[model samples]
Target: MAWQLHYTSARRGPTGRAGFQFVAETPGLPDGVRAGVTPYLSYRPPPDAPPSPDDSELGLFPVSLLYDRVDGRPLLLRCSYLGRDYSGRYGNFFAHAVVAEPDELEGVRPAELWHAPHWTHRPEPETPVLESLDELVPGAALDPEALAAWLSASGPGDPYALLGRLVDAVAGVLGRGHGRVVLVADDVELVARWIAVVSYSLPVAAAARLSFVTYTADPDGAAQRLVGTTPAIWASAQHHASHASAFDLRKGVRDGDASRFARTVAGCWRGPDLAGLDALGELAPLNDPAQEAAAALLALCRGDATVTAAEEGAAAELLSRRGPGIPEWVWRDLVPGVPSMGLDLALALHERARAAGAAEVARQCSLRVTEGVSDALAGASALAEIAAAAGVAGRAGVPVDPAEVSAAAARCARRGGGDLGAALAGCPGGSRDALLDGVVAGLAGARERERAAVLTPGNCDLLYAHAGRLRAVPVIACAVLASVGRRRPGHRIPVTGELLRLDGETGGEVDAALGEVWSEPPSAGECADLLDAHGDAMARRPALAELPSRTFTRLAFPGGDGLTEPAALRLAERVREVMPGGRAGRDAALVRAYGKAITAGPAGAARALADLADADGATPQLAGEAFVGAARRLCPRPPAFRAELLAALSPSARARLGARWTAELPGRARAGRAPLRGAEVGQRNELVEVVLRLRERGVTEPALEAWARAAATRWLAAKQLDVHLARSPRLRASLRDLLGDGPPSRGGR
Candidate 1:
């Protein structure tokens, strides 16, 4: 009752032949024993050469042990072939062959079997079960130096890192309590490294429980399905177990069927056909959550079918569980469809992404949440969540939307009275002005009553507290003052020094508002009227001295007469310190008024004039001219007053005025005023200097001939002129030619 078996090798071509040679008659040594020699396949035949029997049977192929009907003995048909080695090169190949039944193989099981070409003398080595590294390396030591070296050279596609991932996938699959696992990979290096990693990295129990298989290409044929179930020898990696069935992606299996399962492929392989599984929508479980999630997300991303809510939830859960290790492509595929997948899934992924320190992924998730939210409160809440996440991410060296953070804070402040200062504090430099503008706009929308409540005299610190930047604080403070003034017309809105010194748009707005409310009086009315209206308020805000140039000019020199009004002088002085210089075409009228005020002889008038002259340096000529004109117009009745005022000026000031007065002499002479006549000694000296200057400029001979005619009639009658000629040798020298020997005395006249 022994089974008879035989093996044969053949080739087909013009020079080739096919024949079944009787290699052995087998009453096999044991079920695992075989008879025959492995074929030589190291030298690959040319593509046009006839196919050989050794090349035909390269991988795990199906076969059976059949019982003979008459003899009651088993029978087998044996064929043999060559397969690629683990390294993928067709050299030094291990042989695979099947011995058939010649009177049936004795002592061998009369059941279905999977066979490959092999030599009877070269039995395949058993895969070593590895429970710990100690089984492979001494003391279970991890070589840190080797590891560091590898990592230094390793990148995203590093073989070792890929191997690590595959190992993790294997452990994950085995942890689910599957008794059998099949790994399929197209790459020789991946397959080889996977084998090594399994033995060296995985526990013995896990490694021993798994099975692996390889495939052979049939150029002109499809794989034949075996009738009965049996353990298949998958290359040298499969375990000799009766329950381990050969994997076929086209085969159907029930969910409860533990007898057969090909759960995952190690490399790129398609999932099992959906129609092949008893569960209608269930795909073959992937080896790891990351892969499973990526596949599921990809389905949604591709729009291949309408994904239900349940499927999206399942994918989100998978992502959360395996987020840190998931490849970047998965996120790239998943994020685009996140909005339609529901906010809950996005939220779940957001947390997972942030935890994994994938900042951009987290930001994308948060943005998707923002896009998905439809309700106002919910939108605001989503923005708040984004802002909070941004802060945390910022500290972690990750970026989120700072603008969104600012917007969220502003919204929250509007809703719950929160401080916007905190929201604005950490904004980047480029964003500060934009955030400040938002704050200002938000404050401007407040109710009149609300503004009055917070914009009180004592709440200046509140302005700084919420205004974010120092320059911006004044803007907001000034705005609040203007708004409160408009609402409560008589409200004593105290503006801060910051507001007074404000620049930019805020400064202009505040100044315009001040002019509108405490307006400059018309010139017909005295400056006393303006003082009566705004003096109390001006007194209350001493910081008014620091008002912006335009606002200071408006309040200090209202009606162009306030500078000279004794009643308005204190208020004028208070704001005068901050007056803008004349560069931008301001300060001319103010200078004139100020000069007139000085002539009025109010206390500190001289100091005021000096301050004005310094402050309006750009208009020094105008100021000097104004002072000289004012002295002439206002000090005429008391001629000595002019001398006193001129002496009180700085030497530079006096020089400027003297030059200006001398310039005016030609105009005065054209107006028929006596250019050489003056009431005060200083005035007389200035006129005498003008005449001496004309003489120096070569006008002496003509001027003396012209003046000699008028000198006899007008100049001799002028007593001050007579006295100057009596003492001043220079004055007498010029008139000596005109008077012809110091004549024309008072008696002669």
Candidate 2:
């Protein structure tokens, strides 16, 4: 009996782009088995063609001949398009012989076989499904028997497993050369089966040896024509449908949720296992406010925390304890976060500190008011807040002792010793004008006796501590002196000069009188003189002078050029013994001075300058100037020495003395004059030679222009006849223009 492959196409609706159905004629042989001996062909004409089934046929010779022997046994026949015909002779005829039960062959009932020789068949047409074996058998398949047998002697178990084993065998054969193996199957299920079987059979070590798998579709005769007509068969095939399954599997692995099979494979490979956080309670205690505040305060002390939540918490706690009053240290911490801390928070802190009776804290808060002033000075937005705080603190009855405050201020000043001169120099007005109000405030409550005592040697420490702030010194000193003088108008505290002039006669008496009110002698000069004298006294004071030499140096000469000759010499001597050579700027200045002095003349001022320069090479400009002055002075008496002076010029000096060379040449030419009987040949020759040399030496443009103009005029007059023989066109034209067409005259001669 003849058999037929009968199955309904899966009813994926008209909206469905493609559909697939597995014809299971046999059961229990595995899901992939299709066993049949019967083979028939049926064709639907191209959708645009006439609706006639007679146009297509399946015939005897190739199909029926193979089927007759294989009857009752299962056979797998792949039917695909051969262009216009379904005859086996026209296209590729693929038939697999196999064994199956009668039930496996039941649905495959025999259809009519066309045995005619008159019909012509077309060559095999291309179909997306049959193009690559991967489409028929996906890489994720479970059964790889047919594929493995095709690739090697090993019968199929799993495609990847067989692939890995085959790879090792090949590697051994070729000593590890690279290659590829392609497996063709009937459908995607077969491919998936291959991959599944191979992957399951092989150990992880073997599985890793297998590298790549590619899938492709196999199309039937119907699919071939329909392919180019709509969306192609490859895109609308079982292989393509299987891609969703493969993609989902791959995505799940990437997202850490692999298929059970893949998980097993991965587990066997012993790859890294990542697990999520389980115990987050270990970091709980850090969230406590008080602890955080204490930590922040500690961090502030260590300079680790700044203007943060922790710092704010600490500030709040400190303000609560000290009322609104906060110490300078707290302010230092708060300053960076000032804007964020808000004006209300700052004011609240200050008021709270004041209420807590913390005077030191209150003082600290008031000091922060100065910070607002500084910010205002810096042009910050918070200046208004700072000004308001300063006003409030000033009126808060804070009883800040000026002396005590001054002492603290003095300490702050000492910390910025180098900055004192700059601060004083840039003071708004003169120091006297600057601190007059502060001085008046300081003197307001003091008695005359107290003021006198305050101005005496006992308070000298305070005055000396702030010596650099000359702005404060004069006003304070005047107030103290005026107060003391007012109290005892007739008091004659013998001055030191008076005592010294008296030769010890009134020394003890003056000392005793001064001690009566702890007063000092009145100076001969008035307040200005006293201030000058006070400055002199401060300068001469041993302790102030005993500061580090660098401090003195900075105070005396802030810039490199500010150093005087003596100072430069002193620094050079000191540095030479201490520092290495090749130090530029100050050090080079000294070296240049020393060199200049060595070359200067003995009778000239250059000698003194040279001596000063050579002593330590200080102030090279001075040495150079002195050398020039001395050269000018000695030039008339010792004219020959002029060459030596010119030779002695530094590169810079050479450039400066450039104009002098031309100026002196004429003087040298006119040195020996003669009666105006004829041109002085020797002098004229000398002038010509000098001019030639000047031109050769690349003299400057202006000097050259002047010299050239003079030479042209003189030449024309001296050699009026030679002017006709002038070789230079420019010179000839100029001479002709100046003298016209004149013969040699007496002046010309």
User: Which residue ranges in model 1 land beyond 4 Å of their true spot?
Assistant: 1-165, 169-289, 292-539, 545-656, 659-734, 737-749
lDDT of 2 by residue, 69-108 (tens): 2333433232322222222123222222233343443322
lDDT of each: 0.39, 0.32
Query: Residue 44, candidate 2: how far off, in angstroms?
Result: 20
- lDDT tens readout by residue for model 1, 35-58: 222221112222322343244444
Query: Candidate 2: where is the Cα deviation over 4 Å?
Result: 1-162, 165-181, 184-196, 199-749
The C-alpha TM-scores of every prediction are: 0.28, 0.20
Most accurate candidate by TM-score: 1
